[model samples]
Target: MLFPIFLLASVAAAATGVIFKPGAWYDGLRKPGFTPPKWAFPVAWTIIYLLSAAAATRVAGLPGAGAALALWAAQIALNTLWTPVFFGARRMALGMAIITTLLVTVAAMTVSFWSLDRVAGAMLLPYLAWLCVASGLNWRIWRDNPAVPRPAA
Candidate 1:
């Protein structure tokens, strides 16, 4: 019951990537040398989404789950916002800010979930690791691309 709902929410958040897309703007950015290959993005995100849903499902009905679930919702909302800000609006700095906030929120959520269910908290470890990579990538892009090309009027 709860798994489907959580999965649906995760899928909806993931949908932002499809809608905004990297397209040419992202391709033109001065990516860090360590940037993951283009194919890795979707694959990694797929796994993250599945893990996030599972983690949420594991903790949803447990005692004292409210604050942790709130963090989950907040992180997902931030996740949904980052795609459009970075890909659609081409704002690297703002994207970095949002991702940083997401990282903190997820970390807090992980610790909270850990208190309720260790496995659920453990499931979020990969997500936290991925977010660190993503945050570094965003920071590098923002630092490297100072004079970003403005979208054509």
Candidate 2:
């Protein structure tokens, strides 16, 4: 029950990536050398979504899970917002801001989840690691491409 709900939320968040794809604008960005290859995004995201959903499902019915669940929702909402802000609007700085906030939120979520279920907490480790990589990438793109113009309304 909870697993499906969490998976649905992840799928919805992933839909944004499909909608605001990285086409010419992203291709033109001066990304860091550490940027993962183009093929890695979806593959990594697939694993991430599964792991995060599992973690949330594990913690969902436990005692004192309300705040942890809220953190999970916050992180997911932040995750959903990043794609459109970065790819659709071409607002790297704002995207960077979102990702940074997401990173913090996930960190807090990870800790909260850990307190509820150690395995669930451990499940978020990969997500935290990925967020680190993502945050660095977002920061680098914003820093390296100083003159990127936002898309017109």
Candidate that would win on TM-score: 2
Clash count, one per candidate: 0, 0
Candidate 1 stretches greater than 4 Å from native:
none
TM-score of model number 1: 0.97
Give the alpha carbon lDDT tens digit for every residue of 1-153 in model 2: 889999999999999999999999899999988999999999999999999999999999999999999999999999999999999998988999999999999999999999999999999999999999999999999999999888889
lDDT score, candidate 2: 0.95
lDDT of each: 0.92, 0.95
In the range 1-153, model 1's lDDT, one tens digit per residue, is 899998998899999999998888788888988999999999999999999999999999998999999999999999999998888888888899999999999999999999999999999999999999999999998999999875664
